[model samples]
Target: MYERLDKLRAEVERCKRKVEDDRQRLKAAEQKLQEAENTQILADVGALNLSPEQLADFLKLVANGQVGSAGTVSTVTAVNKETEVETKDDDDYDLEGLEDEEN
Candidate 1:
């Protein structure tokens, strides 16, 4: 009976090790999947930074219209340019509330 109990205990210990190994493998796979997703998202963002003509064609398709209105296209371009300028200006100055903190 003692020999049988020892065998059972050894088997249980082996099974626990196997379970821990499988869990670690699962965690690694999930991390790889997340990294792949992040890489794909970056690629998509890069694709969007195309030339004006290419961007206009893409927008037309996304809007489901054969032709986008000239005014709308101009407005979007202007807004993008303005935002770039604004962000550059923002970088020249420290953030308002953060700079004034006592700490």
Candidate 2:
């Protein structure tokens, strides 16, 4: 009878410890979920507020030199300017060809 009583007491202690561990895990999980919810809310706000052009420019800026990568603002800006000039030159050529055809 005494041995059986000791076993019951040990089992109760084990159950208590397990319950405490489960409670701690539940609390940590809830905290993590709350953090994720906050992050998602911020992302939604940004998506709703920033226009496509603004978002594109921001991404370009980050990709260029802001993200700890090996890129410089000067280089990225120069490349973009170069691309614009090429596009403008192509437009000029098209206009010239149209003028020649008219003549």
Candidate 3:
């Protein structure tokens, strides 16, 4: 009977070790997933090509849920392509600089 008990204890120890190993693997997988998500967010924001100040201002606007001049809440949505947001009239922005950059 003691021999049987010893074998059972050994089996329990093996099972515990396996559970600990699985927990470690799960933690690693979660960390990897979080890092990948961060990278994807950075890539998405970087694709906007806005300057640091512009990006900060845009983020603040989004956080505040405000739209331009209307003082209304903004709606967040996903788009597969870049959409042109007409913030100002053509004369408001320096087109010559944009033209220079295009060349």
Candidate 4:
């Protein structure tokens, strides 16, 4: 009986660890999905003016904390300027309103 009890306890602990690991994996997946969605939204809004190479370089610098406040500000300003230039004189499609009307 004691041996059976010990085996059951070990199984329960193993199940608990599995549950925790699954939870962590789910959280990581959700974070990745959010990042992908944000990237898509930026692309749709014509706000992502940086090329893949530029984006990779910027992300590396930011991740390493090598980008100080001034650097951060300048990067943001440059992106905004590019986006403005790209979107200048563009008419709003108002897709949201069109969807609402269709509904």
* Best candidate according to TM-score: 3
In model 3, the clashing pairs are none
How far residue 25's Cα lies from its native spot in candidate 2, in Å, is 0.2
lDDT of each: 0.64, 0.63, 0.72, 0.64
List runs of model 1 lying over 4 Å from the truth.
50-103
Model 4 pairs whose backbones collide: none
Per-residue lDDT, model 1, residue 94, is 62
Candidate 4 all-Cα RMSD: 10.9
Q: Give a tens-digit lDDT track for model 1, residues 1-103.
A: 5999999999999999999999999999999999999999778857767656555555565486533454433212223432331112334566887868955
- Sorting all predicted structures by TM-score, with the top scorer first, yields 3, 1, 2, 4
Winner of 1 and 3 under lDDT = 3
The better-scoring model by lDDT among 3 and 4 is 3
TM-score, every prediction: 0.49, 0.47, 0.61, 0.45
Q: List model 4 lDDT by residue over 5-102, tens digit each.
A: 99999999999999999999999999999999999977854565576655665566667765555422322212432342112111333468777998
- Which structure among the candidates has the greatest lDDT? 3
Clash pairs (backbone) in predicted model 2: none
What is the C-alpha lDDT profile of model 3 across 16-96, one tens digit per residue?
999999999999999999999999999998998876666666777667765435543334332223443335433566689
Which residues of candidate 3, in runs, are more than 4 Å off?
67-103
